[model samples]
Target: MKKIKGALALLAVLSLAGCGAGSPSSGTAESSPEGTSGSGAATALEKVEVGVIPIVDVAPIYLGVKEGIFEKEGLDVKLTLAQGGAAIVPAIMSEQMDFGFSNVTSMIVARSKSLPLKMVAPGGSSTGDTKADFASVMTKPDSGIKEIKDLVGKKVAVNTLNNISDSTISEAVKLAGGDYKKVHFVEMGFPDMTAQLAAGNVDAMAAVEPFVTISEADGNVPIFSNYAEPVDDLTVAVYFTSDDYIKKNPETAAKFARAMTESQKFADENPEKAKAVLPDYTSLEPEVIEKLTMPRYYTEVNEASIEKIAEISLDRGLIEKIPDLTALLPSK
Candidate 1:
């Protein structure tokens, strides 16, 4: 998969406007500390650079851009595209980007390692309504695979280890009264997994987004869905920045958050708006985009969810220990 990055320096230099203003300018500016809230929402920003992945879940960020929400925030915003959240942390930490959409788990994991990260806003939540967004474990009709437990010793595919795919796999294994260690786990991207399954290379897949919707349409029945299991309220998408950037440019940071929050409002109030604007930033088909699962739009990180994911990470040994949740979230 390709990695995406946005230009932080360029966005810090643009002019600001109100929400849904006019044509947004893309500029570069000197770095400064970002805002906390209220007044900071209207604060001027030199430039606001944001990194985004192509998943339909992050449609709000694109909607904000398409609807001129960020432009109206009295700021100039620049968007950098990337393949996944894994690519975003490094750029933010390196000070190459100002803010990026990410899963709270990634931020928690990074924070546990002292990566100097903070989640400034809530992105969205994957609920029953958004259950179809996940990469799921599906079985062919009458495959006798009644539950995740049935997959014991059977072949299963995941997008990556310890990611949403892996997390879902772990949850399913536990839910089905099976053990993760007993299953044969394979790592493959969503596109490759379907073909691999067709060729009999895999038995099941813990898929995400369009793949899940597509898989169901192809006749595979869902054995279990990650979003429906209530494993963790872990954010699948959020806005994050490195600690250094927060310390250096607080005002700029707050401005970026304000702009993002405005975008989130647009997305929440107008699903069609997201459906209309998301194609510019993602490869999802227009029809597929409209059908994809979209979560409640939030611009702040949920501390409780972050804490829960940290515990899960510790249990799975993805992180050495649970992180101090308070330190990982944006200051109130």
Candidate 2:
């Protein structure tokens, strides 16, 4: 596996557009006061840089940073926003970022290829609503595609090829009684997919929040909730770091995870706070932001949902083999 690190690194290029992460520009934001506690005392709040895409799924982290939730855990959180997993993964590899938020499929692919990575906390989950979810399949209003099965032989735009969008969309079409293998996948970014679909470049798209809401606002219709259509309580993404980071900064890692868990729970229970912070991180309009669907957050990583994803990856030939979940998931 060490000998093939070069080949394995390609897995990092996988996009998180399917998960609705933001554009590919490097922007930084420090939400909490430097080295200050809630009481305004000059206690040291450890500075932490976390690589993340500016998508709806990551609202919890932004909320956590803004609300001083991380500061409550002795962390001064800085969000380093990137467009896709490609940028985040390499940043984590070099210790440029202490941790990253990524779609579970990208992490599974990395672990399967012997890249020493582990999910430290759950970042996001499916809403468990089949009729409505954070991620879905969108088509032009006049496309005549009424259901997932109608997608057969159609060109579907996804954030990246061989990632969650393609896998879950394929499964959805199959469940709809269509020949999943016949579906053609076109690589696209979430930011561009809506326009491309309207321009007739693609028949449909596997879209996530912001886009799902944006597409509908443009008169495009959502035909299926790909994240929920095939699996219940599907785990979409998580926060993670390399084994090297954990080994050198175990305390920091633990603190980050605890803060993240707290943030996720807060976001889930207080959905308004999560939505309120979207403007701070993303460029989406307020109308769209308010209407966008939110993902479920969890303190514990759902091993069952992740295993289902790994199984789909193996069955779809995305990963070489099933990843060792025991080694990949957090011990705590």
Candidate 3:
């Protein structure tokens, strides 16, 4: 996916807007450190760059910035918006980003290839909450596609091929007694999936919020929640960094984890606050943000959920083999 890098660069030029530095590694302004002096003065903060996608699932990261949680933990985080996991992986590998938000499938694939990456924190997860429609398989209302089985011999758009979107949809199709191999998978960006489906360019689309909300508003019908069948309470994505970076900057990594954890707790308790920051990072309107299905943001890494994802990837032949999952986590 070398082409993905160029695509991400173009997308960044067109859509990048936030409180972060213009580039992934451009932020260097530091603040006083964690503790205060006898006179109640704070110490200096360590500056770090984090890469993310402009999706509602990353609201906690933006919330962390707005709430000063990272600053309080002696970290100055610069959040860079990348197109997707394919683009973010290369950035982390090259040290362009200190940490990144990526799906577990990508991380596992990287690890299986011997890339020194480690999961530092949870990005987003599925709690099997029926009321919470974080992701879904959506199609135009008049497409005559009422169920997953109906997708046979049809085109399905996913953000990436052989990733979370494809894996989930494939399992769902199988459970519905449909031939997954008969479904054609098209690679498209999440922001553009709804439009493609609406325009009859693709028969169906696997979408995550706030696009899910957008598509529904545009009269698209959701066949089912994307995470409904395969694995319940799955950890969809995670915050990860390169082992070399972590080895050289252990303290900064820990501070980032602490700050993110605090941000996760705040978001879990105050969904309104999490939703409030979406307008700042994403192009979604305030009305859309208000109605978007927010992902379950957790602080602690779920090894079991990640393992299941790796197993699924192997089963689908996305990865040659499963890597040692524990070795890919941050060292205790």
Candidate 4:
């Protein structure tokens, strides 16, 4: 592990501007300035910035910062929060961010198009326990969307089109005897889904935490747990970096992977500690944080889980073909 002086100060300032308390929209990438690398090993430490979505699944990254996990690895980590992988992936490709937290579906699509991205570590995953809800399709109690079958011919909102939500929901709908092709999906941010559903703008919305917790608290009824039917114990998201970063800074990438691995293990074993750091990085209330369904965080990149997602993406025509999974992940 290597340490660089003065980098923590910059991280502290970015943390406030990007992930200030009670301000969700403030965490977007506009708040993080592009990092400049100096010369030598110290330069790598100073230039380490990770782009993440402001969601509960990424809690371990915040916890790692607070718990000195990244610091112990001799890396000063600047957290850049973005609304979606669509934004983060482009930044990564442009060399604006060293690493990014992204869903596997999006990364698969990116690799399929020869985007030069590689998964360095696991991000978050489903528990596969039907009782433990990480993501779901929900609607207003009065919306009459009692089952997955009801979603057909309705405008269901998803955070993204032709990604995880679209693929999973389509499979779930099919499993429930619904015509998956007839279901219409509209792209909407998670933060706006609840409001849109309430206003009768969308019949149902696929939501992940803490929106799921927030919507449930607001009396919305969940039609089905998105991870339950289509794929159980799914690897939802992963931490990735551009191929250039790995080639130029292998040591830095390895240190980051090790630190994140420790953080993921800590998060998995100590849910309360992981939850404790949420308020520092997200706009979710403390009460809501306590109630939100936590995603399973793991260290080792699961090839099988990723292959399943890629297979689904291929089936849905989201990607022209399944990209080589072995090359997409770093050799451990």
Stretches off by above 4 angstroms in model 4 are: 1-47
Q: Which stretches of candidate 1 lie over 4 Å from their true place?
A: 1-45, 129-135
State the C-alpha lDDT per candidate: 0.63, 0.81, 0.74, 0.76
- Model 4 scores a C-alpha lDDT of 0.76
Give residue 160's lDDT in candidate 2 (0 to 100). Answer: 86
Ranking of models by TM-score: 2, 3, 4, 1
| lDDT per residue as tens, model 1, 102-179 | 766667677888787877877766554324534357767666787777888788876666655565567567666888
152-185 per-residue lDDT for model 4 (tens digits): 9999988667888888888888888999999999
Best by lDDT: 2
**Candidate 3 runs further than 4 Å off:** 1-42, 330-332
lDDT winner, 3 or 4: 4
What global local distance difference test value does model 2 have? 0.81
Model 1 clash tally, residue pairs: 43
lDDT of 1 at 226: 61
Per-model TM-score versus the true fold: 0.80, 0.91, 0.86, 0.84
Steric overlap count per candidate: 43, 0, 5, 1
Best candidate (score: TM-score): 2
- Candidate 2's C-alpha runs over 4 A off are 1-18, 35-41
User: What is the per-residue lDDT of model 2 for residues 1-332, given as tens digits with 9 covering 90 to 100?
Assistant: 23222221222232454355555456889866766546877897788899888777888888888877788888888889876777788889998999998888988999998989988989889988866888888898889899888999999999889989899889888878999999999987766777788789999988887667767767788887878868778878899999999999899999999889999999999998899988786655666667778899878888888888898889899998998988888876
